[model samples]
Target: MYIRSAAAVSPQASFEALFTGAAGYQGEQLSCIEPDYTSYIDPKLIRRMSRIIKMGTAAAVESLKAAGLEQPEAIITGTAYGCLADTDAFLSRLVEFKEELLSPTAFIQSTHNTVAGQIALLLKCHRHNNTFVHKGFSFESALLEARTMMGENEITTALVGGVDEIIPASHALLRRFGLYRANGDSLRLVNEPAKGTMAGEGAAFFVVDTQQSANSLARLDALQTWYKPSTPNRVADGINALLAEQGIEWKDIDLIVAGRNGDTGDDALYDLFKKDIPETSFKQYCGEYPTATAFGLWLASHILHEQRVPGVEGLKPRRILLYNHYQQTHHAAYLLSAC
Candidate 1:
């Protein structure tokens, strides 16, 4: 399948801005640099949608517009934490009001599949719509389903994405579990390894189809995911098998985009996996989250389309390999090539 158009509401100001330099974070969180909703959404509707919904809807609209399609045959989304702000609000109201005199708006939009449903509603696209929430494998699962539907001729085009966000309450709770450091730097996230990684969140969307369009970004050659591998060698074996199945040799991969989250133990596995494969990481730019690989995929697609690495100069790649895992589990690999 080919990724025809890709859009993101991430920490960086824009896609080109990321190549210039990553935005820095002072503490243990990297919040999104949100765009003006008046341009993408109706001002009245914007007042009702939560942060996650706004971000997801904006990316979906931009992706469809860029793909030159008013509507898609399918809308699929994956989110590890869905409508977290709404959920937090609903619970807080429930506690404060003692289960009385509470509005249903927050409760209505607190579902895990709310983003997919909202997009479908906004586009009047009453087609196949689904959402996956499988912890770290959320985004990979959504991509796999889209690929299967396209391969089976079930759908010609699909709108797919992964969205997640962090709130103050959730951030505090997660920090209590030692998920983030007390103080950190996003610019030096990968360069300076530590015991914990910063909390990051964003939304990324793509228009994918079997047919190549004029605006096609890159061809998604293959995708694979593994869960709970017994050892690191198993991960390597999986990578080798995927390459062999596609008749692609290791040398054919011009660049490897790895998911090194800046934790000493988490990054050690990446160091062992990529042995002199000219690998680079995206966590330093996007921070560490379950669906952060969606950001990585977006970056790789642009690299192949533009034929230039963000910070690296004068090196063009025809084929790119993207590998990411969440907490040493839920491993995934994707092979992308220039279209």
Candidate 2:
């Protein structure tokens, strides 16, 4: 039900082979430049894994190792674009090689479930293994499922994660569809801007279990995701619902971690609320990736454990509420109370 050990590989120089540290992004670009695969993956295994599979697998391994577990009862993942690099590579081969002598290596690894499958294979976990690919909510969806598993006692240990990779042709396609900007310029949220949100990519994995994990960093108070927001008042109402459910109050919290990615007008929902709760800004570090929210979650977990707010990461947060509004149509919120 709670994230005990969370690890990630993000564009911000967070390279743990499985976990990465806070590295800054310089441009409109956000990417996970992976750690050395040779170090974490077997050479024989390295040749076959697509980047998504590698990212998820490496994170899972490190997270479990950090939690001092051999394997989880279930492995679940969320991905906006699964094995995108491999899919693009296969498509290129399909055209360049005339689909004549195309290798199945890339194509075989190109599915949404490949990452989950590979983790299961490596861990030899034959229990619950599943994947969800739902645009931006992919990772959160996986996390929600793991929460259910924990509550039901169907599984005690669950490895849940989100992984996404950038693909050139897909970026071009997104640009054409107006999901991206024209000049490849960095986009930040304004009260009102001209265009849309920026594109970002990363992988975040968490070791979750029913047992009281000694490595537990944060205790999850609530997790919420919804579509169709009518007003800032509605969001406030949602926050109230969470607070009421958890017997928490607005001023009882120490920090707030917000995903205000500087979307044209999309982040307004959070902007209006921060005025009331008043925590720190997390998006400035991770940028506007869909799962960038994961960093906020991971940071909150770390903050709870350290019993001290991390420098800039905690500059404004004490109760650490992971909050975000995406695509102008989706809003997600998570509340983490210090343990």
Candidate 3:
């Protein structure tokens, strides 16, 4: 499939800003630099939507506009933690009110599929709408389903996205479990390895079609995912198998965008696999999240489309490989070509 267009609501202001020099943070979490919603969403409705919903909707709208599409044939979303703020509010109200005469707004939008459903409602689309909530593999599962539907001739175009948010309650609970570093630096996350990585959250969406178009950003050649393997060598074997199937070797790949989240234990695999390859870490720009691979894919697509690497001047690549693993469990690789 070809990526017609891509958009993201992330911590960085823009793609150029992210590549040139991202803004540094001193806190343990990175929040998205949201865009103005007046253009994408109704002024009156914006107040009702949560942060995650607004982010996801705006991104999806921007992506569709870039693709010159008004309505997609399918809508799919992947989220690890969906509408966390709303969920927290609903649960708190349930306890405070003794489960009597509680407002249903928060409860209504607290489901894992709320973002996707909201998008569909906004567009008046009744096509195949689905959301996957498989922790780290959520985004991959959504993409895989889109690819399958396209292959089966069920849809010509689709809007697929991965979204997650960071709330105070979720952050505090996760910090208690030693997930984030206190007052960690986000800019130098990958270079200066440490015990924990900073928290991150964002929403990224893509418009994909089976046939290439004038606005095609890149050709998605291959995608593969692996679960917890018995040994590290199995990962290497899987990489080889994927490359062999694509009829390309490691030397043929011009660039590699890896997931190195500054955590020593988490970044070890990325370090071992990226040896001698023209590689760069993306987590430094976006911090660490469950579906971070979505941001990595977004970066890769833009790099191929622009024919330029952000910081690496005078070096252009034709093919890019994206490799990321969520907590060393859900591993995924994507091969993209500048076609």
Candidate 4:
């Protein structure tokens, strides 16, 4: 399958802004640079949507528009943390009011599927719709499901997205677990090699189809996920296996986009995996959300389409390999090629 079009709304002003290294993070949490939702959604409807919903919907709309699609045959989304603001709201109200009458709006929008469901509702797309919430594998799972659906001739085109939001409450709780860096320079996230990384959230949507067209940005050649590799060599073996399945070798991969979040353990694994291949990190730009690899995919697609490497020091790539892991357990590799 090929990506017909791609759109992203991240902490960066835009996807292009992220690609050019024009965006920066100053604090611990990197929130998305929201677009003008009113431009894509009605003011009335926008009033009720949460931050994640708005980000997801706007990204999906832009992706569909770029592909010249009014509606997709399928809407697949991946969210590690879904609608955190609404979830927190409903729970706080439930507690504060002592289980008395509560508004259903927050509760209704708190589920993991709300982002995908809202996008479908906005588009009136009643086709095959699904959402995956498997932590780090969420986005990869969505992409794999879409690929399988297309391969089975179940759908011609699909809107695939990865959406997540970082709320203050959740951010504070996660920080308690030592998941975010404490008083570290944001620009040096990948180089500092710290115990934690900056927290971030964003949404990225892509219009993918079985056939390539003039609007095609890049080919989704292969996607594979592994869990709990015991050793660094095992991680390398997994990548080798993915490349073998594609009938290619390590040398054929012109660039490797690594998910090096500056965590000492995770970066060590990445170093072991990419020791022989030219590699670059995107976490410095996107931060360390579970679905941040979606932004990595968007970045890789742009690099392949524009034939211009980002400011990262790496070879200009014709075939790109994306390697992402969560907590050093859930590992995924996505192979992309210039179309």
lDDT string for model 3 (228-252, tens) is 9787668878988999999999899
Q: C-alpha displacement of 164 in model 4, angstroms?
A: 0.6
lDDT of 4 by residue, 21-112 (tens): 65777768777889999998888889889999999999999999999999899999999998999999999999999988887999999999
**Top-lDDT structure, candidate number:** 1
lDDT of 2 by residue, 1-339 (tens): 666888776665542211234454444556676788776678898789877778777877877877887878899988877888888888889999887778788888988899889888888899999988776677778888989887887888888888877777777776675665443333233222445555777777888877666677667767888767777678779888987898878777666766766555565566577545545555555556556666667767776676555343434344667777666666778887655
lDDT of 4 at 197: 84
TM-score, every prediction: 0.98, 0.88, 0.98, 0.96
Q: Model 1: runs farther than 4 Å from truth?
A: none
Which residue pairs of candidate 3 clash?
none
The digit string of per-residue lDDT tens for model 1 on 1-339 reads 999999999988877887776788978989998999788888888888999999999999999998999889999999998999999999999999999877799999999999999899889899999999999999999999999999899999999999999999988888997877778898888889999999899999999999997879999999999899999889889999999999988989999999988898888888766556677789878888899999999999998898888777787888999999898888999999998
Alpha-carbon RMSD, each predicted model: 1.0, 3.4, 1.0, 1.4
Q: Is candidate 3 or candidate 4 better by lDDT?
A: 3
**Of candidates 3 and 1, the better by lDDT:** 1
Which one wins by TM-score: 3 or 4? 3
| CA-lDDT, candidates in order | 0.90, 0.71, 0.89, 0.87
Candidate 1: the clashing residue pairs are none
Instruction: Mark the 10 consecutive residues where model 4 has the least summed lDDT.
Output: 14-23
